[model samples]
Target: MSRVLVTGAASGLGEALAAAFEARGDEVLRTDVSYEGGVETGASAPSSTHGTFRLDITSDDDWAAALAHVEATWGGLDVLVNNAGVAGGGRLDVATMDEWQWITEINLFGAVRGTRTFVPMLKRQRSGRIVNTASLAGLVHPAGMASYNASKAAVVALTETTGHELAAYGVTAHVVCPSYFRTNLTSSMRGADTELAGVVSHLVESSPISAADIAAAVLEGLDRGDELIVPDQPARDAHGLKQSDRATYDLVMRAQAAKLEGAPRG
Candidate 1:
């Protein structure tokens, strides 16, 4: 069975993914900053094959410590799931630099750091998988969530590049672009201004899938050696829109924004 290390496993999609892997008889090491009340109390905790640990994805020291522990305990890691992320939504013109950096740090840089530090261990194994949790926002631009959109976009690019780089080493990378899934990510979303609150709320209300479904898709993608896994219908459609016509996608998003925001006619 593969030994998997999942970051952000304390809650939400990460927690669900960890449980799913463990249920399938894979060795799972679940890590997240919130240890006491996060995944520790959820479905992830009761899984027979899962173990929990504390991990702060934004800290290099935390990453080092977690990896060391995994190496010592499991001997080596066969899969690394970079699933920790934060969400922020609002007008780009009003977004603060601090907000942008914070979102990028957890959503984009955290994945980069995890991949960088764990790639060597994976290479030592001579075969492994890296799964980065990118959002559908990465595939298509949506209004009022500029920071989250940009960070996830970066994740997609990073995953693609890393997959190419690690191919010769027998390491595979998968980027999961999931559409609105029912998770606490919406509750955790940070906003510097209240101007876009209604817009963000509307987006959250449009969620069509569950976190468990996304988690299942992630595992399936890994098994199939798929590079890009769009977990739900909305994600697939968003990706198609991106590939087919950029202008049309933008127009559609604008219309969605106007409808959600209840804006007056121009």
Candidate 2:
């Protein structure tokens, strides 16, 4: 039985991950920013768990307090799932700086802060795992998701560096880059174009993959010790394209604008 801490566990993929771990007899510390209304964060299943704690990923104080709680309650963590993320989409030229900062702070820097806080504990234990939730947009740059893409790509890089730095200490780090899946991320996204947001929302809503599917894939990755995990076939394909052929990938992504009406003609 492992001690795990999963961020953004109120709902969606995070919730599913927490459930999955609990099912496997792991003690999970489930935390999320939205603890009050939209979704209940504290629900437990068949196994033991720490009731949801209010964790705003953007706050350093929150990270400190969370670590304190983990140290006090569970002593040390075996796995840290930095799964909290917010999506943003709009043309690079028109997207607001606030949107960029918001996405970066929540999606990219959140993982960084979590890693910085927990690496010491993991190193002390001499065995741990960090799973960062990135997106296919990070590996495969999309035309309208520059802010989101850049943030996730940085996470990918961070995870890679972490894998190298922590391997000797018996701590493993991995990045989960998934494509469109049904989740609340679409509803909460911040961006300039409502229509474009809707388009992405539609894609997620219509997608066959569910949050549960992603959670399962993530668990599989952890078990397999994958350094970089692409959760679905679409994400795998996208990552492969980017790795094998950059020019074709860019052209294909840029050509996506042709399908979206009113997207700035480039």
Candidate 3:
């Protein structure tokens, strides 16, 4: 069984992923900012059993502690799932610099920090996987989601880069770009536009698939060695259309933009 570490594991997709790994008999370290009593930036622990820990993804010190924790407890980590992120978005003109930075810090740089902290260990072992949770917005940019789209797209690019750069060391990287699904991701939603935020929430709540379904698809995709995992059918269809039919893709995108133009700003 592989040793796995998952961020944002208290609920939603992260929780599902941690449970899935445990179900497969893998040793799992579940973490989230919601938990308390994280070790100081440089504390040492001899060992720990499979369980949860407090991990604030945006904190460098927390990441350092996490790396140390893994070394002490598991000896090595086989899978690192960077799944912690906040939801934020708005029209480019409406989104403030603060909003952009807040979302980018956790959504994109959070993954970057985790990968940076653990890559050396992965390289030394010559076998490990990095799984970043991006979004369908990363691949197919929709209107009124400028900041979120940019952040997730960067994650996709980062994963692609790592996938190529780490191949020589037998380390593989993957980015999951799932569309709207039942998740508590909206709980951390932040934006200047309330209407847009509600729209996002509705989409998330109304999705046909659940977090467990997405987690299962992610695991299957990892087993298949797919670098880009689009787990949901809606996302798959949208991406396929973007690839195979430029005109239709443009029309769909523009139609959404038109609706946004018609809606009252919050």
State every prediction's TM-score relative to the real structure.
0.90, 0.92, 0.95
Greater lDDT among 1 and 3 belongs to 3
Q: Which 10 residues in a row give candidate 1 its minimum summed lDDT?
A: 36-45
Q: Tens-digit lDDT track for model 3 on 9-106? A: 88999989888887888878888898776532213211222767899999999999999999987889999999999899998788899999999999
| lDDT tens per residue, model 1, 6-43 | 88886799989988988888888888888752224346
Model 2: CA > 4 A from native:
36-48, 245-247, 259-261, 264-266
lDDT of each: 0.82, 0.85, 0.91
Which parts of model 1 have CA positions greater than 4 angstroms off?
Answer: 36-45, 48-50, 257-266
Model 1 accuracy (lDDT, Cα): 0.82
* Model 1 steric clash pairs: 10-39, 90-144
Clashing pairs in 3: none
Which lDDT value does model 3 have at 120?
A: 95
Candidates 2 and 3 compared: the better one by TM-score is: 3
Global CA lDDT computed for model 2: 0.85
